[model samples]
Target chain A: MIGRFVARRAAMLVATALVASVAVYGALFIAPGDPATLLIGGGKPPSPQLLAEIHRQYHLDDPFLQGYLRWLGGMLHGDAGQSLTYKDSVTHLVTERIGNTAFLVAYAAVLIIVPGVTLGTVAALRGGFGDTLVTVVTTALMAVPTFVMSVVLIWWLSVQWDWLPAYGAGEGFTGRLEHLTLPALALATAWLAYVAQVTRSAVRAELASEHVETAWARGVPERFVVRKHVLRNAAGPLFSVSGVAVAGLIAGCSIVEQAFGINGIGALLVQSAAKQDLAVVQALALITVVVFVVVNTLVDVVTAALDHRVSLEGTA
Target chain B: MTGSPPLLVVDDLRVDLPTRDGMRRVIHRADLTVPAGTAVALVGESGSGKSMTARAVLRLLPSRARTTGSVRFDGSEVTTLGAAGLRRLRAHDVAMVFQDPRAHINPVRTVGDFLTEALITTRGVRPRAAEAKVTALLREVGIADASRRMRQRPPELSGGLLQRVMITAALAGEPRLLIADEPTTALDVTTQAEVMAIIDEARAERGLAMLFITHDLALAAAVCDRIAVMYAGGVVEELPARHLHERAAHPYTRALLASRPDPAATAEPLRAVPGRPLSAFETGPGCAFAPRCAHAQDLCHTERPSLSPAGEGLAACHFPAADARVTPQPGARSTPHGR
Candidate 1:
């Protein structure tokens, strides 16, 4: 059953790749601007020899299908093509940006998971005043947009207090962390709210399940009941949500990257789009789509692991 | 095992749930005493609140639910104990095997991990020691190839196997009182019997006092030493297992006994009580069962009944039934009450 699911998933991924390649090929045809002239500018509009040389060099002079095939073939060979904006290999540009985004996501994920889950659990355990307080705080945080939160955080922490860097990707890991901290926290603000809410609801639902009642009847400690029984059993839905949230984080990071002036994938896509670079824009769009699909697939696998009721075949 | 002191003493216990309007009583002043190592059954219908009464004794009631009166487990006032004390007591003195073991067992965990985690967490046993104990427990519960099955998830096992594993996990703490709440409800008849045998074996081996809650009076009769019949929010009857089928005094008990199918009397239609028990808050000033009782009198409606000795058993009834048995037919194979 697992093998069948894996095979079907791999097939779906291949289909996605095919569709994405076709879309990218179509995009070049539909785009109004001519890349050859755009590259050289209107200063005597580069001689036909120079234009032909540029087209031939980049494989742009070939028929659209042939050119698309060449690009797709390069992808198969682990090449993401060259970026028209930066005049550098797309792979190098994407890799550096991806690393920075990954670090931000990792640190922010820890920030949200550790505190958000703990607060949720404590709220569940201490039901009356504590729960109400958490609900209020998380609700307020949830209502605020991430970008708006970023601006507020920056003004207070960087502009007003001058504690951290206000803009630009920092130097090393420590420097990058300092630069990414504000935006990550702003991004995490919404996620923390979501995680807290999911955690609270899931824990409460599990606590109400017959099995938890059985555990209580057996004299399982309230703490153990909440920790071992409730959390683990309630984890199925939360695990799936967390997986989807990771995908969302990647999408949201683009905006956060702009707000924080981090030279990440989001910034790259914006730069490529502003320059009307069809190849780079299409590549970035397809990469985002692939990320979403892969994350959703991982969510299915995680949920299946947590609960026997979910069949992997059913997901396929 | 036979001569041990009473393990749980529940006296005048009342569990109530709070709603928007007011408190709606569930278990009403239920008093039950189970001798150590004895099996006591709390038999009731789906909403009769038998489960609620059991939950209150352990302080496991939901936040909105409250309990009045005392629950003394092994001479400790369970309600009065602090959180830490309750945890200690739960870990060392009591354990529960639940209904629908398939859903109760954590699906992601291996049987070995589930049992070992319980052992280490509750008993504070080291991992190595816990593993050996878990292996023995798995064997005792009749799981063949214990080592191999130990690493398998709950879904990989049959319903009977899962129940056995739950039983084993319950036993890991060596609890003095074992609470099995309709533990075989989800199993097939054959598997049910096997599960019962496993439970009985474990009970005898450990001399654990069991509170077996079920709606199946026949199954309860088969396993329990004593039976308590709960109706509405109160226990309507309590009697020895032998006396229940023969001399059940409460009208509710008699109706329940009559409802059981009789294979011998093929000509007679299966009899069931005509109306359901009134809602907990809907009970009249008198007997809670008066609404459904054929023998209810004016006094039964006007005055509430308490647990008093009626004929050979303790029951809450204004008018106890004279004959608990069904009028026997000539070709009767099994007793009218035996299913």
Candidate 2:
């Protein structure tokens, strides 16, 4: 049963990634300006002979369908063409900066998971004032946009306190972690609130569920009841919601990376798009799509694995 | 009940619930006893506090509800037990089977995990040993293929199977008292009969005392040695099971017996109980069932009659169906406030 579930999820991931890659590649064709400019980076005006040589070399004269198929075939073979702005290899540029985005996502995920889940659990287990306090705090956190949060965090933590660096990716693990803290927190704000609210509701619902009451009556100690029964039951929602919060960091990471002056892929995409660098934009778009598809698939798989009802009976 | 002393004694229990309206007494008064190795049925209509009284045995009432009562198990007061005491009671001395087995077992967990949890956690029984013991208990409850069922989740099994798992889990701790609260309510007729038979056979085999809660009078009579009929938050009558059909003294008990369909007399109309059942909070100053009682008089409306000896057992009525009536039992008294 587990084998089948994994097989199905893997198939879905592959199919979704393929569709997203096609869409990303097609976006390059639909872009404004010359096709030859896309192929040759347009840094200098091209002669007719040079244009013809480029067109023939790239099969630009072929029909749109053939061209797309050729491009897709080339992408599969690790030939993603060149950026119109930097005129650099798209794979090299993307691979170089994706690591930073991955690190930032990990940092922000740490921020989101720890406090988000704790506050939610506190709200659920200790009601009345604790519930109201969590509600108010999470509401305030979510109400602020990520960029605004970024600016404010920088102003306070960097300028006022002078405790951390304001911009630029720092060297080494410790330095980078130190420099990334404020940006990571800024990126984590809205998503942290999202995870917290989801956790709160999930815990509340699980607490009222009959099985949990049964656990209590069975004299399973309070801690085990909360751990094995309550939190374990709530884990399904937490997995999927936390996955979305992290995978959705693309948008937040873009703004935070720019505000922090970090050399990350999200910021690079924005810069590339502004310069009409179709290759870099397409690559980053495909990467974003792949990240969402993979992360969501992994979340669902984990959820199914954790829950027998979901795995054997399929999700309800 | 013969030769064995009472294992559980619940006397003059009252529970007050906080609702949207106000604080209402849900369990006005509940009194019953289960001698060691005997089964007692708490029979009642909906909202009569049958389940509430059962829950009170373990302090499992809602958070805001106020309760004052005496619940003793094996000569120890259950209500006053500390946390560790209560845990010991629930884990080792008493175990419960709920109405809907599907709802009571965690859906995500395997049947084995649930069955072995108390054994592992409370008894300090090793996991492998617990599994072996649980498997034996499962077969004892009539589940033949225990291992396969253990690995399966709750949703994968039928209601009867899940209920058998509940019974297995209940017996896992080898508790002296088993509280079966409408254990077969959610099953189909065939499954209900099977589950009840399993419970009856298992309880008898283990010499375990049971408090069976159900609405079915005949079922109660069949599985329980004694039947305590509840009416609107109070036990209106308590009598030996065999005497239930013949010597029922309370008007409500007689009415309930008459309400059952007589299969042999196909042409006769079914005798439905008059008026809808009243909830715990909705009772009046008089007897809770007095408004719908055919034998009710002016005095009956003025005050409530407490449980008094009548015939083989006890009945709470100003005018019982048996010859003893008009002159109330000597020690039986009424308070100004009926509740």
Candidate 3:
């Protein structure tokens, strides 16, 4: 089983890499601006001498295959070539901003994931008042977009109450946590609402299942019934959804990061896009793709661990 | 005084289910007693209140189900017991085996896990002790290579094997009264007999009282010491196994007996009751079985009759079978003679 999972994951990663490479190459080649014009940025047509210099600088003067192979080789070495506007390596720029985003994601996950899922389970078990209250609260939160939530939190917690830092990671770990809190909340609000709904519904379905009634017939205590049977059985779907939630966070945090002025990967991607830096943009997109692939892969692994019904061969 | 008291005693039991409109009685005024180590069958068609009777005995009915009547186990009134008290009762005194054994065992859980769970929780058996008990139970249920089968999930096991596992799980708590609701309905005939034999062996070995609920009268006659035939929501007749076959007094019971395919009557058409049972929600001042009872009269159609002594046993009809007074076996009365 372990061998099968490892083999499947390896195959999936290869497929994902091949697809990402195609997308990266296509986005750079098919866009309106040529590399020469973007590199020099002259209003009129560039002089032949300047154009030649630009082509030579970027190795674009080489054959298409040669240029593509050279770029692919650089990627294999973890060097994503140089950013056109920043005058730095795309790899270095992504790495620096990625750590800050990772920190923010970790904090939000801690705050939201555990309590959110637990509340959903509780609401499902104790239906009437608790379930209705949770349903209303989560639905209301879901209606508000992440940016809207960020702005509200900024207005109330940061500006009005002056509670936590509004932007950027400060010196220490604790300082970074303070700065990341609002943006993390903004991101977590939507995900938490979704998780709560999923967990509650799954738990309710499991609780009403014939197996649960049979468990009760066996005289198993209500608590053990809820924990060992209900939670364990319902957790498979919850883990898969949460995996998507994490991937969504990586792909979607651009707006949230920008709203808070945090120099995270999302904000960096947006900055690189505005400057039309293809290497930085391609590199950032590649990182996001890797994050999504790896996150979903881990989700599959967790789902396989929890549910014996999932077959590695079939999924692959 | 030294002898064991009745294991399960139910008197004037009533269960009402609340619906959107109003309260409707599900099980009406049922009274029964099962002596220690005795097996009694509650035979009835669907919606005959047999399952409800079993559920009422265990206090396992849903919260919306309002049960108002005496359900005494050993000596205590079960209806008045608190949730914790009921749980203790279920764990130690009266464990129930449900219908659809496949659904009874968790599909995702292994047979060993279910066995161990009941043992540890109900009996307070430690892991080592529970494992030993589980192994013994599997063997006792006649599962060949029991240890290997224990490692498999219910889905991996056949229907018969799953039912045996259910019996084993029920036995884990060492319950006195085992309420089996159509335990063999899902199995083939051969497997059903085998499963029934296993249950008999287990019950005999443990000196357990059993309430076997089923619609098959012949199967009930083959297994039970006494049979109670339910029609609509009430038991129309109660008698010993032989008496149920030879002296079935109620019109519904007679219809059920005649409906059984007769090998002797090779040319005669099979007999069946004409219509479905009356709806539970349909209110009536008359007999619920009047529409289907061939012997129903102005009295049977206008007034409901409670169970009364027809001959040696109870029948709910105004007129018992005239020829049913002669007991089939002269010595048969010795088996179930009671106060």
Candidate 4:
């Protein structure tokens, strides 16, 4: 059952990636700008013959379908074309910045998942004062935008206290962690609140379910009731919502990355888009789409595995 | 079993729950007992506090629920027992089978895990030994291929099978008293009979005391040694199961017996007790059932009746039926009670 589910998901992943690639490629292709002239002519009024030659050389003169197919074929063969803005291979540009974004997102994921789920579960179990406090705090946190949070953290933690770097991706693991901390925190604040709220509601619902009551009636300890009955049942919904939170985190990273002046794919995407760097933008958008699809698919598989009522046979 | 000292004695047990309105007395000074190796059925309609009385026995009421009366289980005071004491009591002495087996059993867990969890966790039984015991218990409850069934989760099992599995899980602790709160209510009629039979056999074989809660008075009469009829959160009559139809002293018991549909009486419309069932909050100062009672007098409406001995058992009624002779109806079926 699990094997078939994974196979189906893999096919879905490939199809989703192809569709996303087409959309991103088409959007960038038809967008109002000429990347070849922008790069080769450098905003000057170059000779008409020279501009024509540049367009031909760069395959800009090719028909839309032909150009897109050629790009897709090159992508299949490990080539992502050259970035007109950076004057480098799109793959190299993305690879260099991809690590920084991955680090930032991974760091934010830990921040969001750990404390978010913990506080939420605690709030649900303890209720009353603890529950009220968590609800109030998470609500307040969610109201603060990511960029606003970034600015505040930069001002408070970096400018005022001078505790860490305010901008840029630092070298080495420790330095990167130190530099990434504020941006990740800024990026994660909203998601952490969201995940906690979801977890709190899910866990609360599970706590009220008959299975938890049965466990309590059976003389299972309160802790075991929460662990085996409540948490296990709540995990499916938590995992599912966390997938959406992860995609949100990735989307929000562009703003956070720009705020921190970090050379991550998020920052690269924003800068390249502004410059109309179609190859770089298309590549980054395709990667983001793939990641979102893959994460959501994994969440579905894991949720089905955890909950017996959720069938892998498409009945669900 | 009747001569022996009761395994559980609940004396004037009152449970008040805080609701949106106010503190509503859900169980109104209920008095009942379950003797060793016997089944005592607490029969009532919904909201009649039969389940509340059962929950009170285990100190398992909701957090806002406050109980003001005494419950003694196996010589230990249940209401006063601390958390650890209550845990030990529930773990070693009492087990409960809820109404819906599918809802009560955790869906993510396998049948084996659900059955053996309490044994391994609370009793300190070895996992292998617990598994063996669970397998045997499942078989004893009439489930076939118990070992293979153990690996499957609750959703994989039919309602009847899951209910049997629930019973097997309950008996895994070898509890001295089993509290079955409408254990067979969620099953079909045939499955209900089969499950009840399994419970009856288990009780006889283990000498387990049982407090059975149900709305079906006939089923109660069939399985239990004694029946306690509840109305508006209070038990109005207590009598031997055999005498429930013939010697019932309380008017409410008579009404309940009359309301039960008989297949042979299809020529006549079924008799139903008049008036809506009252919540605890809706009861007045007098008898809660007075509004619906055909025999209710002005005294029954103004003053409550305390339980007193009437004929073979206790009943709370302004005028006990013992003083009046009750002849069996002419067309009444000769069979004892249940279909």
Error of 3 at A255 (Å): 1.4
Regions more than 4 Å wrong, model 3: A42-45, A59-69, A312-316, B1-5, B18-24, B263-269, B324-339
C-alpha RMSD of each candidate structure in angstroms: 4.7, 4.0, 3.7, 3.5
Query: i-RMS values of the candidates, in order?
Result: 2.6, 1.0, 1.5, 0.9
Candidate number with the higher DockQ (2 or 4): 4
- Kept native contacts, as fractions per model, are 0.45, 0.75, 0.53, 0.75
State the lDDT of candidate 3 residue by residue for A1-316, as single tens digits. 6458757887888799778877886677666766667777758878989888876787755665676677778887998888888889888888888888898888877656787898898899888998999999999987999889999999999999999878876656988877888998998988889989999999988987877887887778988888878998898999987888878888668988999988888998898788778788877787788778988888888787776657534444
* Candidates by lDDT, descending order: 4, 2, 3, 1
Candidate 1 vs candidate 3: the DockQ winner is 3
Clashing pairs in 4: none
Q: For residues B1-339, could you state the per-residue lDDT of candidate 1 as single tens digits? A: 246447898888887798888888877768888888899999999888887877676677877787888888877789889877887777778787778887777666678877787667666789889988889888877876999988887878899988988888888888888888788898998899999999998899878899999999998999999999988878888999987766787888989989989999999999989787665677878899887888888888888888887656688887776553444423223212200
C-alpha positional error of residue A258 in candidate 1 after TM-score superposition, expressed in Å? 2.8
DockQ per candidate, 2 decimals: 0.43, 0.71, 0.52, 0.75
TM-score of chain A of each: 0.89, 0.92, 0.93, 0.96
Clashes of each: 1, 0, 0, 0
RMSD versus native structure for model 1? 4.7
Question: Per-residue alpha-carbon lDDT of model 3 for B1-339, expressed as tens digits?
Answer: 147667777777888888887888887757777888888999988987889888888776777788887889998888998888888887788877777887767776688988899778766789888978888878888887888987877767889888888888888888888899999898888898898898888888888889999999888998888888877667777888876766666778877887888898899988777788764456377777888877667887777778887655787777566434333444333222111
lDDT string, candidate 4, B100-212, tens digits: 99999998999998999999889889999999999998998999899999999887899999999999988988899999999999999889999999999999999998999
Q: Candidate 3 docking: what grade?
A: medium
On DockQ, the leading prediction is 4
How close is every model to the real structure, measured as TM-score? 0.87, 0.92, 0.92, 0.96
What's the distance in Å from true for residue B200, model 1? 3.0
